[model samples]
Structure formats: structure tokens, C-alpha cells
Target: MTGHVTKPGRALRRLLAPLAAHAILIAATAVMLLPLAWMVSTSLKQSGIGLSRGIEWLPWRDAWTNGKETVDVMVLGARVAPGDGGEAVEVGIKSLASRRRFTTVYVPEGAFEAEIEAWRIRPLTGEDETAEARWAPFASVRRRVAPEWGNYREALEKMRFWVCLANTLAITFLGTAGTILSCSLVAYGFARFRFPGNNVLFLVLLSSMMLPSVVTMIPVYLLFRELHWIDTLLPLFAPAWFSVNAFAVFLFRQYYMTLPFDLDDAAQIDGCSALGTYWRVLLPLSRPVMATVGIFCFTHYWLDFMGPLIYLNTSEKFTLALGLYTFKGAYTTQWHYLMAATLAVSLPCIVLFFAGQRFFVRGVVMSGLKA
Candidate 1:
């Protein structure tokens, strides 16, 4: 009876240990999520104080009393051009009265441009222009109070968003698929076969991994130009098929090395060829490593701004990273629109990461066990 009671007590302790570990993990997870929460809070904040509408210009006050000089509002990027086009303009206001700055206020892109242009053409307007023109001083003061939702709409509409998104997806999918296939095959060869000069060849492949990415970028560009692959997705996807991912190959090789050789031997004994054995036996058990490789490939291509910027000359082929650049001006940037676009663009990556969270955790844990 005492032994039975002690056995149950031991089992309870084991269960409690994992429960305690999970509680600590939950706390760490919350800590990791704080910055993202703050970014979201700022994105949704209104532009001014006591605005009835849910949305306000920028979230904070304008102007600062640092007293160096009355700082003019600096527009980060304009969402829309003012006029009949009706795009929204992103505005930054520095209010001398409030002594703070407003970062992401929306004004009608058309309205902002029209306001500035109207000021430029003010002398030419006849007295009969309108009742508003007759009361120009009051109009000027009231101009700052209007909401500018059209600017946001206009900016969102102009940027071929769907097209850019499609291009990005195509590149990422093809790149990841090709890289995994080629890297896995090459890795299988290195792990299983004892060919002549195998060590030397692998050493060469490993050495290329140490080369700076910048050093080869120009050459890659030139080669792509010669092959007429630039400005298209071909240059982006084709490299992976040709075994460009040395690190991936190395990773796959390490994983394959730990696979039981008896399985390969058994397959051979059953009259299976090398390719058949690999395909039939080894691949079936390779899900963890494949998932690991997939995650890496997805992230690398998804966040690759420089590659798309250099190769994709047309707006139609632009990735999200390239499209985001449109919000920037020579002297200003539309922070509101930029922030909105940034949050929007980041959504896909976040979704993918969470969706694959289980596989990612499992694969990474299992992969290290072997290597």
C-alpha cells in the first residue's frame, strides 16, 4: 500500500515539473510580445485631442517648446496628392501652442496640394471666387481642422498592391521549393555516397558560404543581365535550383548523416537502386529537416529587400519591401500611410510564422538532436 502511494506521488511530481516549465514559458512569451503591442497602439492613436471621430490626424500633439525655433511640421510621406485625385496626404504638425509634434495626420492629398497651390495662385483669384475666398483669413484658420480619409484611400489604390503581392509570392514559393529540392538532393549525395573528390568538392562548397553576399551581388546582376533574366522572377528563383544554398546543403547533409545506414542497406538488399532507396526510405523520415529548411527559405526570401530592389526594375515586379519605398519623398515621408502600409505588409509573415509554429518548434528541436 505504501509503495503504491509513493508511485503516484512520483508521477505527480513529474507532471508538476512540466507544468511549471510551461508557466515560465508563458511569461517569456508575453515579454517577447511587448514591442509589437506598443507598435499597434501607436498605429491606432488619433492625431489630435478631443476629436469626435474615432480616427484623428496624427496620434499626438504638435510643436515643442525646446525654443530653438518654431519647428515647421515635417511630412514624412504623403498618401495622396491633393486635387480631384483625392489622395490623402500624411502630415506632421509642430504646434507652437501645444508644444509637441503630431506624427501621422491625414489630410486629403488633393486638399493639401490644392491648399498649397491655391496659396501660390492666390493673387490671381478674382474677388468673386467664392464666399470662402471672401473670408480667406477664417478659411486659413479652419483648414487645419478637417479630416483627410481620401488621402489614405488614394495612396492605397495607386500602388499596384495586388500585383506586387503576387510577384512576391511567386518568387518566395519557387525559390523555396527549388532550394529545398536541390539542397536535399546534393546533401543526400554527400551524406550517402563515397565518390572521388567528394571531400574536396564539399570543402569548396563550404568555402563559398564564407564569401560576402555583397561581393557576389554585382556579379550576379551582371550574369542575370547577360542571361536576360533581370526584371523578371527568373533570376530570383533559378539560382536555388542550381544549388546556390550551401548552408542548406550542409544542414541537410548533417541530418542525413545521422539516418540509419541499415535502412539503405536493407533497401539495397531488396534490389533497390541508390535513388530508389533514398526516395523510398530516407525521404519518408525527413519531415522534420524539410520543415526546418522550409522555414528558413520562407523568411530569407520574404524579407529580401535588396535582391528585389536591384533586379526588379518595374513597379509591377516590386515586392512589399520595394512598394513600401514609394511612401518616402525626397524631403518628406508620410508616416501615417507608411505605418499603415508597414503593418499591412507585415501581416503575412506573422501569419505564416504562427501557422507553422508547431512544425518550426518540432523541427528545430529534432534537427539539433542529430547534428
Candidate 2:
């Protein structure tokens, strides 16, 4: 009698549960996207003057320089390995000295001494060379001062923003594609194949998922440098070929593990090879999981700043994140322009996540079910 009485109430909840869940999801989405909204708002705000005083959301100047003025040179250093073409060496008068211009020049990785030598060797007429010596390392250099807008404009014009964008997009597309193909194949093998030490090997792969990136970065960098890939995008995209992202493989494996054994048996009976069975049958049914994996890979690589920062040495190879970092001076930052560039770079990823959220959720839930 009690069970019968409770059944109607349970039915009512089943009818209402989806609506309630949707409401909660809407609230969560709002919370998640609010920061993004604010970022966009800040990016469009106008640059105002007197930055020292405060920020205003209108185009203006901030204490424009009166005339040629001298600024001190400050150097930041990091130790590098010998024979890496990076060591302090002597130049006659000017030393690379880490940085020359307070605003634009930051020699993150290079021999400061060699930089000084390179600059010193450049031809200068009598008075011009005297002026060059005045601006030389270990001396105060004066130059015509202007507004920060010049820096922003120079960066916009000189920096390979479009080239970097292309490189980044290529890396994102190719890397994600390779990761999906390789991880899916290896994952399906692990899910269905019977072989020696398979369980132990899967465990080892799972353990690798817990390893931090910092542990592998230097060794990977050294390996790439030896391969002559240090300054290229190949280093960025090549790892996906081998299924190095253990987490993605694990995700796909978990999803594949739930597939009915009967399906593979039927394929075998139909004269299908193992790879043929997977390509023809399993892939069509794995859309949700594939979308989930694609979204994850896309988001991870799209926002990657560190890898490109370390490997790309030239301005032409700058990713959006590294390019944005240039808006900031050592002592001050152009907050307005920085914020603008930040929002510009983040919008595409935001659009992608929202478009794929439905598949992401469904894949996550269904993949966890044990058959």
C-alpha cells in the first residue's frame, strides 16, 4: 500500500526533474560565462590619459612625454648551458646587457655580451656613434619620448600577429586531429584486444596521466632542440601523433570499454578485420565521445601559452598570449590595450565550448556506464 502511494509522487518528480535540472544548468552557465562577458567589456573600453591618476574608458593620453628623456636600463638574467650559443662574452664598449630599451627590448634567452657586440659593430657616423655610446649599456640613453600609443601601434604593425595566428590555428587543428585519431585507435585496442601484459600496460598509461608537465618539459625541449625542431611549430604538434596525452586516451578507453561484446563478435562473423570493424562500426557510434575529446583537445591547445613561449624565439612565431604580453612595460602596463587583446584572443575558445557543451555532457555520463 505504501509503495503504491509513493509511485505517483515519484512519477511527478520524474516529469519535473528535467526542467529543474535545466534551470540549474542555466544558472551555472551564467556563472561560468560572466567573467568572459566582463573581459569583453573591458577590452572595448577606450584608452584614457593620465594612467598614473586612474583609468578612464575613453581614448586619451596619459602624461605624454615632454621631450627627449633618459631612461635607465635594467637587466634580467637566466643561466644557460654552454655551447647553447648563449653565454656572456665581451664586446668593446656596449654589452648585450640583457635589455637596451626600457619599453620594447627584452632579451629573454641569449648571450647579453654577444648582443652588445652585435650592436657595437653596427656602423655609426661620428656624432651618431657618440649618441649611440650615450645610449650604450652601462650608460643612460636619451631618446625622443612619445605617448604609449606609439608602442601599441608599432606592435600592431611590426609583430606578426597574423602569421602567429595562422601558426597557432594550424597547430590547434592538426594537433587535435592527430590526437583524436591516435588516441581513438589505441583506446579501442586497449578496450577490446586481448594480449600479454595489456592490463599492466594500461595501468602504466593511466599512471602517466598523473605526471605533471614540468617533469617532461626540459627533456622534451632538449630532444626537440637536438632534432632541429626547437624553433618550429612541428615540436608543438608532433607529440599528438604518439598519443602522449594519456588523459585523452584514458577517456576514450573508458568510453569504448562499455561497447557490447556482441558487436565485435558479429563483425568478426561478417568477415570484418579488427581495424575494419572499428573503422566501420565503432566510430559511427562514438560521436558524443569524439566531440568530448575534440572539445578538450581544442581548449587545451588553444590556450597554451607556455609551450609556444619557450619554443618560439622570433616575433613572427608569437602566439596570441605571448603577443599580448608585450603591451606591458617592465615598470608599467597598458592595462587598456592588454585587456583588449586578452578578450580578442579568448572569444573563439568561448564560442567553441558553448557549441559542444551538449555533446560533452552526454558523452561524459554515457561513457561512465558499465555494460
Candidate 3:
């Protein structure tokens, strides 16, 4: 009886453990996604109302319907006024200070408009300057979800998004290809060949990763200037071809070391040269590492802002990251448009990660296993 009771208790505890863990993971995911949700919400909202005091998850706006047409409006205030019959409800764009002075149009006491007359407010156009005050009944106005989908269209147009996207794509593709080719070659040498000072040379290469890019920024800029590569995409992607990414080389080398040396011998027996063996046998087998490095390089080149800012001068040469900066003026920013553009710019990276997630995880796990 005691053993059976304890077995059920243990089973219950096992079930609850995964449940608790899943609950925690779900909560954490929601927390991490909050900022992205807010960005989407802001992107859909009307310009002036997006940053309201209250937290609104949906894009809502105040809308009013006149007799012929309906239009969005801002509510001002309401007041009592002398009607033809007697004192009745009055609502208008007139301010409280000037309410008594402005001419009022009173609605009948029994009218539906009179029931909501107290809720009326000023239109977005501001105080009525006309001799007669302009107002709408509160019953005619309502809070409705009206997302400004046009913000994205307007943002793309203003930011020259297509041109910037093209430039970013060019740089990302070229740079990712260069990183993979160059880093793999270096990593192959370190993994396969026997040479004097090989370990020391690799240590020196790895040490470069510890040095901050800020230390070399000025010197690199001067070198690019000397080469007349300033204001061009060459400065952005050319260095990638030289296997400058030590971490990438390290990942490749580790993954290569996991492969058997017999493969190299087999390739040699089949009349394949060292370079040919790497190209056919080793590289073709390194899909996981390649995917991992490609995604990393793609993300880096796609979002690189400082490189483009320092090297490229013309607007046409701007990457998406730098192009987004154009939305902020010296005085004020268009927050809705900025949010829309940001969401648009971030979608590709998000999609790419999800698409290559399996390979990325496998690459990271397998790379460290042997080394």
C-alpha cells in the first residue's frame, strides 16, 4: 500500500515539473515579445493618439459622423445654452474660457443629441474662429479601432526604402559569401595540416578578436581613404574576404576537426589535390557550420550602421539601419512612421532565424563537441 501510494506521488510530481517549466517558458516568451507587440501597436495607431497616457493595445481613434459623411475628430467639451424652447445642451469646438462668448447652437431637450451633448469636445482643427461656433453632438462620436495602415506606405516612401534595401542586400550577400569562403579556407588549414608554429599562429589570430574595433577605426578609415574606397560599398564588404572574423574561423575549425582524417586520405587516393579535397569532401560536409556562419554574417552585414555611416556619403549608398535614422529630425520624430519602418526592417532577420533554426542549433552544438 505504501509503495503504490508513493509511485503515484512520484508520477504526479514528474507531470507537474514539465507543466511548471512550460508555464515559465511561456511567460518568459510573452515578456520578451512585449516590446515587439508595442511596436506593432504603435505602427498601426494614429499619429497624435499613439502615445496616449493610457495603455491601449489596439489602435483606436475618436470618429464622428456628420449628416453627409463621417470623419475622425477630437472631442472638446459641452455646455448648457439657451434654446428656442428653453435652456438646452450645447457642444462645440469653443474653449471653456471663450465658451460664454462664442455663439451657441442648442439642441432640443428630447433629442438624442441632447442626451450626449455634455460629452462633445473640440475638433482637431482647434477653436472655431468663425462668428458662429462649430460643434458636433456626442452621440455622433465614438471610439473605434482605426489602424493607420498607410503609415508603412508613407514611411517606405519617405525613407527611400527600396534603394536602401537593395544596397543592404548586396552588401549582406557578398559579405556572407566572403566570410564563409575565407574563414572555411583558414579553418581547414588549421584543422588538417601539420606545420611549425600552427598553434601559436592560431592563438595570435584569435587574440585579434579581443581587440576592440574602435582602436582600429581611425586607421582603417585612413587606409580606405588612401585607397579611395571611401563613399563606396567596397569598404563595407572587402575586409570579409580576408578571413577577419576570428570567431567564424574558430567555429569552422572546430567543426572540421570532428571529421575523420581518413576522408583526406581517401580523397588523395582518388587523385584529388588538397584544395580539391577541401572543396569536395570537407566543405560539402560542413552544411551546418556554413548555415550558422552565413546567418551570423548575414545579420551583421544587414544591420551594420557605423560602417556605412563612416564610409558611405551618398543617400543611395545607405543600408536599412542607417536609412532608418533619417526619420528623426533635429526637432521631432514621426514615431508611428519610425515604428512601422523598424518593424519592416526587422522582419527579414526574424524570418531567417526561424527558417535556419535547426541548422543553426546543430552547428553550434556540433562545433564545440570535438574541440
Scored by TM-score, the top model is 3
| lDDT tens digits by residue: candidate 3, 259-371 | 99999999999999999999999999998889899988988999898999899889898889988876555214577888889988988999998999887676567556734
Which 10 successive residues of model 3 have the least lDDT summed? 93-102
lDDT, candidate 2, 1-371, per-residue tens: 99999999999999999999999999999999876665544444333322332333233321112145433222222234342234423222112223242332222133244433312222222333433443243332222223344334434444445666787788899889989889989999899989999999999998887788999999999999999997788888899989997777887888788789898899989999999888987877777678888887887777888998889888677677666565344214455455555655677887886898886666556546622
CA lDDT, candidate 2, residue 237: 86
Candidate 1 Cα outliers beyond 4 Å, as residue runs: 1-35, 45-156, 329-332, 358-371
Task: Give a tens-digit lDDT track for model 1, residues 1-371.
Answer: 99988998999999999999999999999899876764454344333321222333334322222234433232233344353325555544444335465444444443446655322211122333443343333122222322334434544555556777788888889999999889988999999999999999999988898889999899889999999988888888889898899878888888888888999999999999999887888876787777877887887787788888889888878887788675454113444455556666778878878988876676567546634
Candidate 1's TM-score: 0.62
Clashing residue pairs, backbone N/CA/C < 3 A, model 2: 49-61, 49-62, 50-62, 95-116, 96-116
Candidate 1 at residue 104, lDDT?
A: 43
lDDT of the candidates, in the order given: 0.66, 0.63, 0.79
Clashes of 3: 5
> Which residue pairs clash within candidate 3?
75-121, 75-122, 76-121, 76-122, 77-121
Shift in Å, residue 187, candidate 1 = 0.4
Candidate RMSDs in Å, in order, are: 13.7, 17.5, 7.0
TM-score result, candidate 3: 0.79
Where in model 3 is the C-alpha error above 4 Å? 1-23, 72-138, 362-371
Model 2 alpha-carbon miss at residue 99, Å: 30
